[model samples]
Target: MKNRVSRWLNNEQHLAYSILIPGCALVLVFAYLPAIQSLRFSFLRYNIKMPGAVKFIGLENYQKILADAVFWQTVGRVIYFMTVGGLLVMLLALGMALVLNQEFPGRALLRTLVILPWAIPPVVNGFLWKWILNGDYGALNGLLYQLGLIQEYQFWMANALAALSFAVMTFVWRYTPFITILFLGVLQSIPGELYEQATVDGAGALRRFWYITLPMLSNVGAIAIILTLIAAFTVFDDIVTLTGSYPTFYDATKTPMIYNYEMTFGMGRFGRGSAMAYLIGLLLFALTFFYIRMSLKKED
Candidate 1:
C-alpha cells in the first residue's frame, strides 16, 4: 500500500489532480451549486412567503421580466451608471498611478493615503459618502457654502440626476484606489530604461507618456476596464446605503442587483427575482466573453 501510494504521488498528473481536486470540489459545492439552484428556482413559482405555491412555471418568470417596461428602464439606467462610473474610475486610477509612479517627497505616505479609501468596506464607504452628501446637513454643502460657491445647503439626493451622480462619485472614490494600485504595479514593472531612452531622443513629458507609457499599459488598462465594468454593473451596497429603501428613487437609481433585491425580498417575488438574477448573470457573461475574445484577438 505504501509503495503504491508513493508511486501515485510521484506521478505528475496524479499529483496535479490531487492538488486540484479540493479546490474544484469547493467551487462545485460553494459557487456552481448555488448557481444551479438559483437557475432551478428561476423557472418555478417559488415564493418565500408562499412556500406552498411552489410550482414549475417554465419561462413565465422570464417572460414577465422581458415584457415589463420598468425592467427595460432599469436595464438602461444600469448601462448608463456602468458607463459613467467605469470611465471615471479608470481615468482617476490612471491619473493616480502616473502621479504615484514618480519620485517625490513623502511618496510612500501619499501612496498609503491613496489606498485608504479602497481599503474601506463597501458598506462603510457607502454610509460615509451618504453622510457627506446628505441634503439638509451635508458636509459638502457646508463646505461649498463656506467657499461661496453655493448660497445655501443643496439637497444632493433629492434630485434624481444629483443622486445618480453622487452614487457614481462614491463608487469612483471607493474603487479608484484599487485600480490605481494595479496600474501602479504595472507601471513599476516597466523598465525605467525605456523612459530614459525616450528622453535621450529629445522626447518631452507628454510625448514620452503618449508613446512609451500608454502602449506599455494597454493590456493592463484593458483588464482594469473590464473589471471596473463588471463591478459597476453588479454594484449593490453603495446604492442601498446612498439611496436607502425609498421607492421614489427606484426608477432613477435602480441597478439590476437592486431590482433583484426589491423583487425577491421587498415584494416576495422569489421566482421572478431569480429569473432576473440569472438574466443579469447571462448578460454579464456575454459581455465578459466578447471582451475577452476581443482582447485575445487584439493580442493575436
Candidate 2:
C-alpha cells in the first residue's frame, strides 16, 4: 500500500489532476450544479409561492409547451431576431470598421462617437429609444412632421413589425461598435504589404477592398457573428422595455428570454419556466460549440 501510494504521489499525472481540481470544482458549483437543479425543477409542477408543494409531472410541461401556439410564435420571433437582425448588425459593423480604418479627417473622434451606444447600458438605451420613438410626442415623429414628409405623425411601435424593427435598430446601434473594434484590431495587424502589392498590380480601390480588405477581415467577421448570435439569442432588457412583456395578442413580439422571464417570474410557473430556461441554455450551448468548432477550422 505504501509503495503504491508513493508511486502515485511521485507521478506527473497526479500533479496534472491536482491542477485541474479547482477548475472542475468551479464548473460543478456554478454551471453543472445549477443546471442539474433547474432540470429537476423542470420535471415537477413547481411554483415559488408554494415551495414544498412541487409534484412530479413527468413530461407534461414539455407536452403543454409543444402544443401551445404562442410558444411556437415566440420561437419564430427569436429565430428572426438572431438570424436576420444579428446579420444586419454584423454587416453594418464591418462597413463602419472598414471605413474607420482608412485615413480621413477627425477619424479618431468619429470612431469614438461610433462606440458611445455600445458603452451605454442596455436598459438605459431602451428607455432612451422609447422617448425618441414614442407615438404622440417623439423626436422621430416631431422631426418628420415638421419636415412635411408625412400628413401626420406615425405611430412607430403601435404595430408588431415597427416594434421589431426598432428592436433590431437598437441592437445594431449598441453592438455594431463591438464588431467595429474587433475588426479594427484585426485590420491593424494585417501587413500593409498585401495592399501595396494589389496597388502595384494596378488594382483599383474597389478591387483592393473586395479582394484584400474583405478576405483579411473574414476571421474578425466570424468572431463578431458569434458574439452577435449569443447576444441576440439571450437578449432581454431592450426588447422588454421597447414592447411590454405582455402586450396585446397582435402586438406580441416576445423572444425566448421574455418568455422565460414571464413564465418564471411574472406568471409564477416555476417548473415550466425552468424548462424554457433550460431550452434557451441548450441553444446557447449548441451555438457556442459550433462557433468554437468553426473558429478552430479556420485556424487550421
TM, every model: 0.89, 0.86
In model 1, which range of ten residues has the least summed lDDT?
A: 243-252
lDDT of 2 at 124: 89
Per-residue alpha-carbon lDDT of model 1 for 162-205, expressed as tens digits?
77888888899999999999899989999999989989999999
Q: Assess candidate 1 and give its lDDT.
A: 0.88
The 0-to-1 C-alpha lDDT of every candidate, in the order given, reads 0.88, 0.82
Please write out the lDDT profile of model 2 over residues 62-160, one tens digit for every residue. Answer: 777778787788888878888877888877877888789889999989988998998999998888887788877989989988899877877787667
Off by over 4 Å in 1: 1-23, 290-300
